[model samples]
Target chain A: MEANIAVSSEKKPTWGGGGVRPFGASYGKMMMWFFIVSDALTFSGFLAAYGLTRFKFIDSWPIADEVFTHIPFIHGEFPMYYVAFMTFILIFSSVTMVLAVDAGHKMNKKKVTWYLFATIIGGLIFVGSQAWEWKTFIKGSYGAVKTTDGKILQFVNESGKQIALSDFVVGDRGDDKVTQTRKNGLWFESGESVGQYSVAQVISSYNANPSIQIRSEKIDLDTKQKIILSREKGAAELAKAKLVVEGANLEVNEYGNTIFADFFFFITGFHGFHVFSGIVINIIIFFNVILGTYERRGHYEMVEKVGLYWHFVDLVWVFVFTFFYLV
Target chain B: MAHAHDNSNVKRIWMVFGLLSVVTIVEVALGIVKPDFLHLNGIGTSWLNWIFIILTLVKAYYITWTFMHMEGEKTWFRRAVVWTAVFLIIYLVTLLLIEGGYLFETLAPLVRW
Candidate 1:
């Protein structure tokens, strides 16, 4: 008991002197690491949930190549090319950030400033590209029908190439029916905006076209391609379509499964938000570097810290790119 | 941190960047081509998927070790950060995927197409 009392008394002074540094790391840096680890776990939870749900609907999941094929101002089907470009931009930004941190270590404010500026530009480009990608995805390339049983049926040519609704869906929509608003209809609140073509228009147009066949979402294990229905069966299935889906939303997706879009929006949006914040933080640090605050302090630890965060964001994108685009 | 400001360190950074870029290029090429041999099922997934996952891990390692300066940190600090995340992530992914597979089996008869 006396020894225990002595040990406790001896430990009090060290405890009062602002706790021990675990592994010689500063308090702020350690706290940042703790936050990062927890944040990483949260991301992992989301991705794991994505993996599980994807596994559950593996048979009907959208092909990543077909879904993410658009590039800005380009009309060709270049699968995974634009996404690879985005990944390279992010990784390059990470490189610039590390260079800035290295420059900061040598007290080279000029070098640090230039590198920081480059990093910020890279980040802005990446964010802009992401927005464009989102717009393309939401706008959709080909229109598909959602059956009453919640299955998506896409249109394809006899050659097995995908066909846009505009290719065969002829005739103008006669009515300009807008979504019902609260003021327009009693007890009705507007939700999402209406799609381009109505179900009736799509059905009639599909029936008029003989070359168009229905492609089911289920992939044939042998061919690794979606199963295409016969012309007669395609017409029969088109009769079961309840709604005309042109693009993706939280509720409906013209792309194979609704859950796939849900995960795509949630995961990529969350990562984009991180990149946005990292740019904001980098801007703040860039100003501090210019103001010579770190010069007076004799160290540019602020740059180093922010570099840590920026690198972390890049790391997460690597995984997101792999799972979402490549896989 | 002080020694990392040297010219060789800059070259090292660029080299790591090259390595990461090469890995990404390889991943993209494989994804685009999807070689017949690589597409064969192995264990639970295709060998191609396993290759992508492994390459992703390699990229993650370079980003953390070089860019984040984990190599400069003390041993315990590095372990504390890396080990915790690695173990927990592996555990979570394994169990969840198993559950997902089971759910697919249960729902197989009910769902159409």
Candidate 2:
């Protein structure tokens, strides 16, 4: 023992082990913060790119209210209600996560387990809600016609109320035009969208219904509304119709610009993935808590580390909500 | 660690949650109603958009400070993370938005995009 003491006394002191931690942070905690900082920059790059695209297409960007006015089960228009609920759920989860950290600090295993469990549940629910939103967005509500110049043309009634192509276009096109695959004849094909109403059917049905007017994708900046063409102009524009577009895809969008859908999917998809991984990490830590790992280790710094990440996700959501939904 | 045994920890968490909820509700209300003056006036966008952005920043602040426990960290530590992020993000956003605006001004007149 005297030999060991002499050896320890002869050793040089390290920074953290000697209680000389720079910034009063443990090495692990400091590293986690650094990771968060870099992760935050990645998200900022995406959001700023989104902003850039939005600014570029400011005039024709889809009105958010018109696109995201969905609430499951309870039909009818409730703009921002569902998303607001989602925001509350995420914030509540964040609260639970912070509570878990607080409980961990007190070394109360039971409270920590309960709070962490609640946090996981909240995360699962949020992810599920996001999936539902994506489904609705992908399936779309109304369909539109694409012109030769790639302009999307939708329909509104005489009173300027938006109408779907299905609202008036008789489903049966009464023609037997099969999809042209690459093997059919030419070396290439247009990759025609099958099982959809043809442009001719939509245009003919549109002409038959005089009450329907064409709404252009272009928004009048001063009004912030899609431009509704006059009946004559609507007929003229209908003559330029090439294909029918429904829902959203990389090449087309029923909700105005395709880039809008791209950013929506990309940004929210990335955030959702973070939430998912956070849940997995939370589960592992929850098991650790049950096993008394932190209690045995003398500190619940792991819980605190994960808590920082959970809150960071919530923080990003706040900005995403503002930019994508509200602004 | 200092607040470990203190009952104030739970109280602070709930208080911040309440504040965040109220702000979100106010934002939703404003978004739904969308007063004409707020939507119509402003230079680049509108007053309503500015309000949303500012309120979003406020929410971000609370989430970072209290929920993320950033305020509890040493001052220099917090600065190293926050200042670095804020500066970089602001620089990128300003330049990208300006570039996007320039493109809009130049290309929009010629092409429909």
DockQ, per model, reads 0.77, 0.76
The lowest-lDDT stretch of 10 consecutive residues in candidate 1 chain B is B36-45
Q: For candidate 2, write residues A1-327 as lDDT tens digits.
A: 446442342354544344445788987788888999999999999999999898887778888989998899987778899999999999999999999999888888999999999999999999999999999889888898888887789899988888888899985765767667767676764775575688889988988888999999788878788999998998888899887878886677888888999999999999999999999999999999999999998989899999998899999999889999999
Which parts of model 1 are misplaced by more than 4 Å? A1-20, A174-194
Task: Report the C-alpha lDDT of model 1 over B1-113, residue by residue, as the tens digit.
Answer: 56645887889899999999999999999999999777756557888999999999999999999999899899999999999999999999999999988888899779865
Candidate 2: deviation at residue B33, Å? 0.6
Compared with the true structure, what per-residue lDDT tens digits does model 1 show for residues A127-238? Answer: 9999999998898889899999888999999898998888888776656876676766567655777767788888888788778899999988776789999988888888
* iRMSD, model 1, in Å: 1.0
- Candidate 1: TM-score of chain A is 0.89
- Residue pairs with colliding backbones in model 1 are none
